[model samples]
Target chain A: MSHADPVLEIRNVAKQYGQITALTGVNIQMFAGEIVALLGDNGAGKSTLMNIMCGALPPSSGEVLVRGEPITSLHHAQEMGIGMVYQDLALAHHLTVAENMFLGRELRSSGLAGTLGWLDSARMDRKATEEIAHLGISTLRDVRMPVRLLSGGQRQVAAIARALMWSKAALLLDEPTAALGPKQVALVLETIKTIAAKGMAVCLIAHDIPSVLAIADRLIILRRGRIVRTLPAAGQTVTSVVSMMVGENDDAAAA
Target chain B: MDRFRHPLLGGNTLWVLGLDVLLVIIFQLASANGAFLNPINVQAILTTYSQVMMLVIAQTMLLGAAQIDLSQGATAVLASVVAGTVLVSMSAGGDPGPHITLPVLFLVTIVVGLLAGVINGVLVGWLRINSLVATLGTLGIYLGTAQVITNGENLYGVPLSIQSAFGSVYLWRVPLSTLLAAVVVAVVWIQFRRGSFGTHTIAIGSSEKAAIRNGIDTRWHMVKLYSVAGALCGIAGAFDLARFTTTDIGGHGNDALAAISGAVIGGTSLFGGKVYFFGALLGALLALILQSGLVILRFPPFYQVIAIGFILILAVAIDSFRNRNEMR
Candidate 1:
C-alpha cells in the first residue's frame, strides 16, 4: 500500500466560519481496495470533512489530492475519478433506473443523428445492467423500471452503483446506512465491501457504528473538528469506538 | 412507475380522448344539419384549434422543466403584431412573392417570440425569481408592449397571398394549416420521446438539485427551454397572421390559461417532471370540441366557457383521486 500513491489524500486542511473554527490541521490518506469508516459524534466535523473532500466546500488552508493531482471543483473531482453519493442519494425518481444512471452523459448515436441529440437507449440500458451486475447487486432486475418503483435498499444500491461506475478511484458516501433497516444496512455494507474488494477506495461517514464496523477495514474517528484516532476496525467494540469518538480516549491519553 | 409511466396512458388522457370522441359523435348526431361534422365547419375547428395546440405544446414543454410561461399568448400576440407591422411596411408598393415575404414574416415573428422567452428565462433561471411571479410579470409586459405597438388597434394590410398559400389552402380536403401544425407537433413529440433534451428537462423538473449534482447546467437548460417554447409560440403567431392576414391583439386574452389548462387537464402535472404532449392535445381538444359542438347544437356561445370550467374541475378531481390511489 505504501509503494503506490493514495487514491485520495487530505493534507493540513482547515476550514473556518468567520470566527469559528470548524476543522483544522486535518490529514487523511485513503488507498485503493480499502473501506474506511468515518466515525464521529454530532458536531464532530465529519460533514465538514466530507464536504471538503468531495469539493463541495473548500478548506481554508491545505491541499487535497486525487491520484497525485489536485482537484479544482466538484465536477473536476468527478472528472479525476472521485465520486460522492450524498445522504439523500439524489436519484430522480421520475426517470427509469438506466435513464437516471446515464442522466448527464447519455450515449448518443453516431454522426449527424448524434449531433442532433438522438439517444442510444439500448446501449445505455445494457450498460446499466452490466454495471449493476458487475457489482454483484442482485435485486435490480429491470433497467427500464422507473426508480420510484424501487424499494429503499434497491434505490440505495442503484445510487451507489452510479457513483462507483462513474468514479474510478475513490467513493465518498455521506451516511450510506443512515436511513435503512437492519437488512438494508447489511445489504449496503456488503455492497461497500464488494466495491472495496474490486480495487476502489470507499470512505463513508457512518452514524450506525456496528454496520460500519462490520465492513470497514479501518476506522477514522473525528471529534470536535479533528481526527483523534485512526485504528484498525478488527475487534473494536462499538462502546470503544463511541468512547474514542466522544474524546474519552483523548482524555485518557492526556491523563 | 407513476412519474415516467407512459404519458399517453397515464392519468386522465384516455378518458379525455374518450370524452372528445363521444362529444364529436353527439355533436354530429345533434346538429340540425350535420353542421358539426360539415367539412367546412370541421376545417374551421381544425385550423383554429391547431393554432391553440401550438401554445399547448409550448406550455407543456415549459411545464416539463417545472417552469411556466404566462406570456406565451402575449408573446404570440406581440409576435404577430410586430411581424405584421414589418410586413405592411415592406409590402407597401407591390407584394413581394409569397416565397420571399412569408419566410421573412415567420422569421421576424419567431425571433421576437424567442426574445420574449429569453427575458423570461433570464428572470426565472438566472435571476432566480419564482417562475410563477416572473412569467406573470412578463405576461403583462409583453402584452402591454403589443398593446402599445398597435395602440389598442389590430394591425392590418398584410400580404393577401400569404394567407392564400398557407391559410386557406387545403390538400386532400384537410386544412393545410392543421397539417403544418401536425408536422411540427409530431417532430416535437418524437424529440421529447427519444432525445436527451427531453430527459434532461424531466430530470431538472424531478429534482433540480439532483440534476445539478449530476452535472446538468440547469440554469442554461431553463433558458433553452423557455426559448424553444417561445419559438413555438412565435410559429403559432406566424400561422395566425398567415390565416387572418392581420393581428388580433384583443383576441387572445384566454390563450395562456387555455394552454396551461390544456396541459394540466391533459396529463402533464402542474408540479412538473412529466411531458405528456399528446395528453395536452386531448386536453386542449376537450375545450374546442365542446365549444364547436355547443355551437352546432345551437347552445349559447358563452355556455362553452361555463362547460369548460366544469370539465377542468372534473379533470383535476379525477387526477387527484387517481394519484392518491396510485400512492396507496
Candidate 2:
C-alpha cells in the first residue's frame, strides 16, 4: 500500500446468475506492486470476483473502482488497465507466438491501415522476441511457431508476456499454474513475483494452498460467496488457512 | 512417434497438397490426353478458379471461425436476380431500365448483402442459434424469396453494357474474376496472416470464453465475419450473373458446399481457430480443376460430387483427429 492509491477497489460487490449466487457483498482492495492470492473452494466465488473485476461479468450490486474512479463502462475497464489471463490462456493455437502476442492490438505500418496494407512484421517480431526474453522465457525457440506447438509452460509464458506487453495498470491471472507440471508451476510463480516486482499490481486466483502461499504477499479467502478472512502471508500455515477457510473456531481448533 | 504426434504439421499439409496436385494431374491426363498443361488450357483453368476463389476466401474466413452460411449461394442468386429484375422491369421491352444501372445494382448488392448478413448475425450471434441450423433455415427462406421474386422464370435480358463491365472485362489476358480473386486472396492473406481481425477471429474461435475474458468483443467480430462473408457472396453472385447470364436455382447449392469443401481442404480447420487463404486458393483450384477435367474426360458428371464428398469426409476426419490429439 502506497500514497499512489489502490489499483483496484471492489466495494460491496455481489453477482448472481439466475438462482445461483456466484458472489455476495465482496469488498477488497488491491494495491500496486503486490501479489494478492484469492483462494476458495470450487463454489466460493473466486472466479466470479475475478470476472467482475476484469469486466467479464457485471456485479449484481456494488461497484468497482480503479484509481479512485468507479468503473462504469467496459471501455473504461480496459482503458483503466485491468487485464485478465484465464486458465485456458485464451490463446489462438493456430497462430504464431508473435501473432498471438498482439491478438487484439497489432502493430502495423502507417500506410497499412489504408489501401496498401502492410504489417510491420519485423518490428512486432523483434519486440515480441525481446519481451519474451526479458520475461526469462528465452529457452523457447521460434517466435513464428504456432502456440499449439508450445509446451504448457511456454504457452503460459507467452500469455503472460502478452498481458505484460499490453497491460500497464493491473494484471489478473486465474489459476495460472493449475494444470502445469511442477517445474512449469515454479516458473509461473517466479513470473508472478517478477510481475509484482515490476510495480504492477497482480491478482492470482489459486486452488493449491502451498503454491499460493509461496508467492502471495496477501491472501483473500472466500467461502460461500463471502470473504471469510483476509490476511498477510508472513508466517501462515496451510492447515491454519484451511481451518479458517472451512470456518473452524480458533479456540475449538486449538483444543 | 512423439515427434509425429506433436501439434505441428507432421506431413499433413504436404499430404493434402500432394493429393490435390495428384488429382489435378490425373484429371488433366484423363482429359485432353494431359494436354491441359498447355498455356491456353492453363488459362482456362485459372479463369474458372478466379471467380469462386474470392467466395472461397470469404467463406474460409467464416468457416475458420466455425460458422457456415447456407444462404451464401442464395444471396448470390438473389443479387443477380435483383439486378436482372430491376434492369428488365424498368425497360420498355428493349432499352435497359435506368432503375438498374450498374452502380445502383452494385450498391443494391452491397446493401442487400449487409442486410441479409445482419439477419444471420442477429440469429447466430445475438439470438444464440446454432450457425448451421440458422443459416440453413435462412438459406431456404432466401431461396424461396428468390423464386417468388422471379416466379421460377430466369431473368435473361441484362444489357450488354451492364454485363460487359463485369463479364467481358479483362485485365490483359486474365479475366477480371481471376484478377479480383488474386487481389482478394492476397489482401486477405496479408490481413489475416498478420493483421488484427485475423488474430481476433482466431482467438474467438480458439476459445470464446478466453476471448471474452480478454475484453475482445467476440460477438461483434462474429457478426462482422458473417457480414463480410455475405458481402463477398453478393459480389460473387453479381459476377456469376454476369458470367452465366441467368440465375438458375438447381446448381448453386453445390457452390456453397464446394466452398466448404474447398475451405476445409485448404487447411482451414472446421473445428475453428485456423485459416490458410493460400491453402484455400489451392483447394479451390484443385476441386475446380478436377471437375473441369471430369467433364472433358466424359466421366459421369456425378463423379465430381463423389470426389467432393470424399474430400469433405477426409477433411472432417483429419480435423477431429487433430482436435483429439491437441486435447491430449
Best by lDDT: 1
Q: Which runs in model 2 stand beyond 4 Å of their true positions?
A: A1-7, A10-29, A55-67, A112-119, A139-142, A250-255, B1-21, B31-48, B90-110, B162-176, B318-328
- What lDDT is reached at residue B233 by model 1? 89
Residue pairs with clashing backbones, model 1: none
Per-residue lDDT of B16-77 in model 1, one digit per residue for the tens? Answer: 88989999998988888778988988888998987888899989988888888888888999
Q: Pairing residues by index, what is the TM-score of model 1? A: 0.96
Clashes of 1: 0
CAPRI verdict on model 1?
A: medium
Per-model C-alpha lDDT, please? 0.87, 0.76
Top-scoring candidate (TM-score): 1
Model 2 agreement with the true structure over A108-208: per-residue lDDT tens digits: 77773534444666777889898878776665666777788788988998888887887788899998998889999988888888888888889989878
Task: Name model 1 segments beyond 4 Å from true.
Answer: A1-4, A249-255, B1-4, B7-11, B325-328
Q: Compared with the true structure, what per-residue lDDT tens digits does model 1 show for residues A1-255?
A: 454789999999999999988888899999999999888888889999998998888889997999888888888888899989999888987789899899899899788877877988888999999999999988898988887677788888889989987998999999988878888888888899999999999999988888888899999988888888999999999999988888786688899
